[model samples]
Target: MRALQSDGAAVVHRDERAEGFVLLSPQFKQRWRFVTAHMGNLHAVLDLAKVADTLLFVLDPLDGWDSTGDYYLSCLFAQGLPSYALAVLGVPDLPQKKQADAKKKLGKAIEKRFPDAKLFPLNTEQESLLLLRHLAAQKQRHLAFRDRRAYLLAHNAEFVPSRDSDLVGNLKVSGYVRGWTLNVNSLVHIVGHGDFQMSQVDAPPDPFTLNPRVAKGQQKKGQDMEIQVSICPHSQQSASVLMQPRKQQPLQSEVIPDPMEGEQTWPTEEELKDAEGSLKKRRKVLKVPKGTSNYQAAWIVDDGEDGSEEEEEDDNMEDEDLMEEASQVVESSEEEELAEEECETMTIAESARDDLYDEKVDEDEEQMLEKYRQERLDQMFPDEVDTPRNLPARVRFQKYRGLKSFRTSPWDPKENLPRDYARIFQFQDFSRTRKHVFRQLEKEETEGAMVGWYVTLHICSVPISVMESFRQGMPMVLFSLLPHEQKMSVLNFVVRRHLGNSDTVKAKEELIFHCGFRRFRASPLYSQHSSADKHKLEHFLRPDAALVATVYAPIAFPPASVLLFKQRSNGMHDLIATGSLLSVDPDRIIIKRLVLSGHPFKIFSKTAVVRYMFFNREDVLWFKPVELRTKWGRRGHITEPLGTHGHMKCHFDGQLKSQDTVLLNLYKRVFPKWTYDPHVPEPVPWARNEQQLFMQELEME
Candidate 1:
């Protein structure tokens, strides 16, 4: 270790906040870049790891890793670990008799987290050299999503504000372009900021190697990258920029909504003539439901058997149903008004009782207990919402309909879609389009800097404050976006709830998602991760198995790993789930299942009378076709309505048990809430530097 330092490796960047080194020396086999920071500063670690190809963990011999180490390990593992090397420090200091036992215990613990990797002692210079060799020889695991895009790790960052506005400026960021060749015509995304366009890219000389041809005291080019970063003074803000682009990349995050879409529009003159001709010709049509033909329908029937009487009967029945519906609606409004008054009085009484006690309540404890209670109730009665007492059963569950078989039933994805769907872009055939785009990118000539080149990018209109973060140890990353990647689409991820976390993760709960290089906040709906046509919505993120998370987000191709995190009150992020992208499928159907329960009032031979399932005879008749089951496994269907009061005569396969409960399963297609935000503020640093002041503060407490 001392000999290597004597040889002198170049430090690409160094400051009070961060220190970076690029090993271009002849002693190393491959180029190596190292960035060191306190693990307590999570922002620095997460940003750096996204572009880093390998991770080296240095550990103590006696205590390999404390609680803090374990926390970081879990985060790294959840975020998809790159090639890693584990080096045990200070093995020579330990007593000879205890060294073997120490290594055995450490190996056991290491095996659980890193099954194939082994520990190396870093006490001797020879051991250190061997570890580096192993790292260089190890096969680099290529991540799918990142492999298709171009990104860079900035070694130098400088901002030159525009003459008009100090807030916006041309930020110069220089680094080695990795992955695919970067197209200057594309948009670049920074870590914290949303997206910006690069004005131009300048070919910079290799900062790692000194050029003998350049004269002394030349300011334009320098061998030291860090020294070149602070080239211009504050007073002299003007700096020479290369040729800028003639046009800018379009910033289109969503599809433009059409006001006339899905609405009646004026017909054309040709279409009016066609309509008149169609009205003149009377064509016999056999119509059932919009999509309900198991076999076929006979459109042409004998003129004598034209079914004229059947049509009259159907029209009369529809009229009577509409009249009954209008009367029930009036009654419901009156009942709802009375219910609201009772709720107001109850709230006032509760507040009056609260005035008796002083407000020293532990809100955190109370919230935790409430969360646990809700979770327990959900497990016992999954997806159970209180039955409305003010509204009719038919009106209350209008959006919901019963399914014969929850697994095999066909659901139309385009039916009953929310208005938000209009704002998103949908691919006609996602798989075919994905393949075509990649093939085109491969054949097209890249417009900007090629990969492995050290180029300076002048990103226009970047906030001056955003550039300062780079100097403060927050690693600023820049990645180019692919074609159509900015448009919003339905994204699915196959993720399993992290076993280390026990907090119940509910469906549609706001969570921070890290998809490879992108981080965003979304409340996603979870479904079964199977390849089935229809998937049942899960109330809880089950830790025992993997599930699919459906969210409306910017379209990112699969092969990218996913990490789900929940933010805590103390400003720390807890890892919830980890997985990879499943697909970008807008047609995937996610149905929320609701269970309605009622008790049997009377039991008879192969027949039973049920109550409390409906409020009137109309609702019983409306849902007569829906199949019913019991807790004891008896299957039945409603035969007839007993009376106006909610009682119904049902026929089961066998004798009904008086104590058994009757259950009905209803389903409705649910969409994720439109709560996607791409920006995540940096969290406060918790521990590093051995926690000197923090440890003292803790001891004082």
Candidate 2:
């Protein structure tokens, strides 16, 4: 109240002393001005446009019940009034932890909408008077910035329009001035009773600037006529005037008047003290009144003390006697009321017990309902050992469900399924059934290229997880894209099962072989024989078979026959003579050496001999000379191919082969240690002799 008066403003609050009239400060009383009736209304927010230069709304978060800080702040924004929030007093105590979060959320919400608006968190010790003083100083500087600015006064109190007021024309502003990003820096100053007039003005300078006022040294931007702030300064003296400390002021006090009415009221200290004393006594007398209605206490206060001070003395004696009668009557009535209340409560308890009994009876009814439900289920689904296909769809689907349930169920198995039903649904090739599928997938020992394709297979009821696991186990074969025929063919070879009605195991479909294509040919045969070729006939007829074959082993085959030699980079030549019969055993390669070309010898070992070169497959007679070129003299090492080259020359720096005849001393040679499995197939017949020779040369150790 003091701060508003200092700012030449007025405030109002409801009062009973003045009846319809409001009270205000001494300064307003001297001018005969009071705050408006609208301002005095507690429910109404003060129309700040008719009050002071800047509006400050001090929001008490705790004042309202269960207030969401966000909601309260948003209401201020919705009003569309350019008002500021004084938040320094701190948040109100909320029922839950959400209040703290709500406070921060509300701050962010305000920042989004009113980015430039100032928010001050006033310290708890500070009051509105201190804040208002600071704002008044700020407004003084704001007015100094604009030249030719007019001041408006309503009922002797300074008034400023809200930011939304259109009358405040856009002022040419530079940078963030006056401690704010000035949106509209000047207003069309219109004041007085009958007619309003406007005058142009320049906006204020930044409040943080050193030279805020338009003084002598500074040149004026336009016509130099500074708008002075009409402020009513605080009149009370400082601490020097007070002899001792005074009581702290309460925040909320009744505003006596709204200045819009031009009336003022300021009460003397003595008069306020008398009112407080009388009110205290009245409350004490009414504290424990005798009454069941609660109406008798009010009648006592009004009737007993209604008259003036002189009439009150005359009734003082009557007051004590009246009080005794009132207490006795009230006590007697309370005892009677208590007895009636107890009876009513007993009736309610009995009603509740009856209700509980009825609820138990209802529970019995539900059990009967459930019993009927079970009977219906049993009748609809009678147990049958064998269900016919000609039965209803429901029965058929149910029977199928039952059969499938038993297949994977944890129950005891019934006897074998009916013979007729099994025969009808039975697999022709039971190799594709679940039992055989799992069995076939586990088998490993197989021959040939270890390759087979299924020709016809259709999968229906298989666990997805099982199928996925099976696919992962087979690394080399990606059977996802293979034809069904190929999968069935492979499964048939691997998996086997007995037929439903027979004992025979199933087999895969046969494969077709193509031999030759021919036109008209000669009838009789003409024969010519060379002596060298005749001797080579033994190799082509019953040649040797070798067990162990080294990876990437090469054979040498001449035009007459095939010969195997273990050729080494170190020029240590060894041979298993041609026409030697070599065979694979369980632990080693068995060789039968025949004296066809080289020395006849037998090699029973774990390692294989490289015996033959190209004959039936491709080129038969071509010999390229070995080229020798190197400074290291490391004997034999093949060079990488040159550009556009066809064949790499075997550059034997040592004089050995231009298809030269070389003999292997089979008795003196060394071989690497490697075991051979005889179950694996042998090389082609003609190449067998060559391989035997090579093994003899490189004898297995």
Candidate 3:
């Protein structure tokens, strides 16, 4: 039963309900709803924040907020924070002597993260009521990532199965539409779940409509949202299905490459006769096979006949000879992180009475220790690999070629790209494309369901298990995909290493990401974040320095924040890094460097003889064009080889000491691994680390 108005004011029913309710205030004359959620629940807090107009954080009076709270706060700030307010409960319950001190300490703590935010003491019901008044009147701050897209916070979701299949069904999700108008023909991506097409949209009655409350009063009220047409008529569905030619967007993520559809067309008799009559003298540009087409011949010309292949074969033969004595062992470190742990995840028991001493031993402890030592060694000697004493240096380091200068040296981004690069997309000008997309979105007035409209989307092909998960209280968020946003592209993110994570993170390692409303796993290539066109690749993610993380992902425009996470053995995902989207440029050059160190055989004024750099005379001559350097701050070059056994005379700007090591810096372009997965495993939900108090009766006998 609803509460009757008393003295010209609408009041809530005395009975408590699980569902959220909107407040109808007589003092402020406004309607509002309160969405309360447990801060410790990871998915709950984040998914709710996405569609929320305002957030009110409740802090403890004694202690502001713990480290765990701070961790989630950083995530919210990075993902995009809407207008928020802070409040402290139980402030008046504190002792008179400690109340002032607690308030002062709380001010200093919150000042760091929220300097301008006013701290409200909300112990009394009256104060809490006043807080809502201020919150409703305050202006809201918009998140750039969410402002231009249509999204829904799933308040009520139900799966209606088709008669043919129980597994597949149309998921009817209802909620208020936020952001820009949502087009019915567009695809919607359910967070965590994959993208699905909408069958149709239905306008439903708003559950939180407060118009009935004013009907009980004596005064006439203004008309708010009225539920006119319940289900959309059949006429509108035809218009949505058969949209204008230009209005329809294609769902193809990749362009199909066809070999049979080339320029191998047969010439007609009329064309052949005309060519035979007119062409007395014709130039044969390229010599191709009998059935070769123009496209295949172009590739053949670009890749010269035998000269380059024979040269590469000779180099490979020489390289193989050097490493004939020994083979390097390669394995992925942290096997637990690489492979999924099948063991049961352990959880903290609730009560002290059920105390069970938890003791777990790591089987690979020694391997982890050795890996840490190797990481330390790499840090001390950055990229320095010792010369193989048993084998020739040319074979061990054949894959690398020396660079004159990492910054100034020219390396084409298109050269030596892997096969996966062909399947990816590239943008001519990302900034201009972004502007045009946003400009088109602003013209959404002619189509789509407008904001604040209570509409249900018929998400086709959603599994029944998704609805079961929704019933279990998992946060459900759905976002409309923009044009071409679902296509694959090389995405670059400007991120800083998360300070909380001390474990070593390296390039080309698989990591889970939360970018805007999408979560996925991808292997990213790391490079120095710089203004120059060419960027030096980093083997390890460094602290206190920003790095550009390049990964193959679906195209998302800039202004989206990125949160990087790595899975732990216990099934929890740890936040390792955070930043924002940089760009979608596939042409950015990232060069990986390998250092070859050699000892100075003999030192002289402006000249020195170096050994162990190359095993054969042919190897020295091939790399003579490349530059060299010494450990003691000297620049040099290989003038000529003194002997066949890898001894080369070098000229330097300054005299080199005998103890100084001769170094050759070789570089090659690096690319991310082809391991882009959209369905990232859901991590163990966040739980509060509650302390249990144990009491024992006096041990007396």
Candidate 4:
């Protein structure tokens, strides 16, 4: 095996016998685009998966089936590719029984994951040729299917309106039309924009090259050609923002102020007496000895000579005790009298007899009762109290309720959906959308002029602002459109309120908002606002604000031949997202969706002897203790450093054999940062510059 120094090591084997046969036999000649993908490199797998027509998964008996291999298998299956096959590599001189056992074990493992896939032993040249023939047959079938589908689309072509030019008269709208036979006079219909006559056709240069295998004499003229057309709509297509349902805020209970304050209602006489009796039963008094007075305690001698001062102090103390007794008696008597008076007043107030002299008291009582009733009414109808006579009796406010999982839920094509539900976007004429190519375009391009291999459109109609977000580098996507028969009624509502100074102030008091895939900006529809409005706007700037805007985003319809949608890109597009089929109906289909791309992570082996590519020692250290997962659902963690080279010791729940793979999952938050030059050669190497060397050394340290 000859090792190639590239992004990763690639092994090339040349058999002398095969070389001579190749020189002699014309049919034996072959060309291959060999790529060596490092384990755990999802990006490399994704890139290679796009170009590879068939997958050949090689399992080594000595190394065994590891998590790394399993991950690649899962990725391949997920792609829903055309063909799959497996090859078991082992020593040619190994015992026949041992080889048979190894093959059997590997076959069982592959069967568990991919039951339909064919397995073969890679022992001799004949076996290798058999695998090659199998792949070639699968490729032929795939190409035949694609050619037939392309022919059908070309024969019955349809163009859906994707974008319109800004010019007014004879508006030259540009969109992609599948179905090949479009001529100068082809008539087309634009859904709501009305029927129009094609004025000119602008065929884009074919992006695909001619097949090298086709003999010069047998080569067909104008193969794989696409034409861009310019046409004028009878009337300009109306532009409207597709709105999603706004989330509803939780209802807040009203706060009512206390109306009766300061005044106290005295308890009835009987109730007061009962209260006093309970207090007496609960109170305890301690007795004091009669001879233990302050005067007696101070007198140490009992002599009668000059004892007159002591006698005076004793008399004073006796007088103070009498006064305290008198005060207590007076307080008890006063409380009894107050209680009696309160009872008398209540009796008088409850008396039905009308007396002229008691009119003043009755009037005061009536006034108090009226005030209490008015306060209750105000609490019940706070809004009514402030509403003007001209205001309507029923006031409706716009409401929004957040969805737990918006992708799988049924949403109306006409109603506004929450921004978070804007996971999938469907472009009507996806082929015409500007694709960003690394190489410069031959002609002058607009801001969103580069046609990407994939076109993304929101499943629901997006706002003009969101549609314009392409300028801000939002990813372009093509969503699987919903079928017409599956369409449902969507509730769309718009509430306009004239917040006169009072409403604005109240709204600004404590404002809260929601932000997700959608953005919110103040509309110009409302009249001038006070300082409170500005404050409310500032409050929305917070990251956790729950504020959302309501705009009508129309639901997009899926293009024809939904199953064949994958073939639309013709190997040029990348599968950046995946969705699970929720339910299918005669008219509609529901899907649970997620954006496919994420940050890239590395996985290291847990074995004592590590044999894989690593840039430096620091790479190993940084990955230490990081959790690694196997494809079969087992997990392990890196424990310690293995050596000076980039290797580490890892521990798993169960002892891992040489065949077990340890992988670390990483994600990509933004795709543009990870973009590569399409025209650049594969396995791009690090430049041998001072800066590169320094960076490499820094990683090592």
The most accurate candidate by TM-score is: 1
What lDDT is obtained when candidate 1 is compared to the true structure? 0.73
Listed in order, each prediction's TM-score against the native is 0.78, 0.16, 0.76, 0.26
- Rate residue 197 of model 1 by lDDT: 84
lDDT of 1 by residue, 185-204 (tens): 78888966777888787775
**Candidate of highest lDDT:** 1
Please rank every candidate by TM-score, starting with the best. Answer: 1, 3, 4, 2
Tell me the deviation in Å of residue 153 in model 4: 24
True-structure RMSD, every candidate: 9.7, 58.5, 11.8, 34.8
Q: Which window of 10 residues has the lowest lDDT sum in candidate 2?
A: 513-522
Q: Residue-wise lDDT of candidate 2 within 188-261, one digit each (tens)?
A: 11111001111211222211212123346544554322322222222132212111113211221112333354
Model 1 TM-score, all chains together: 0.78
Full-model lDDT for every candidate: 0.73, 0.25, 0.72, 0.31
- Between candidates 1 and 4, the one scoring higher on lDDT is 1
What order do you get sorting by lDDT, best first?
A: 1, 3, 4, 2
Local distance difference test, candidate 4 = 0.31
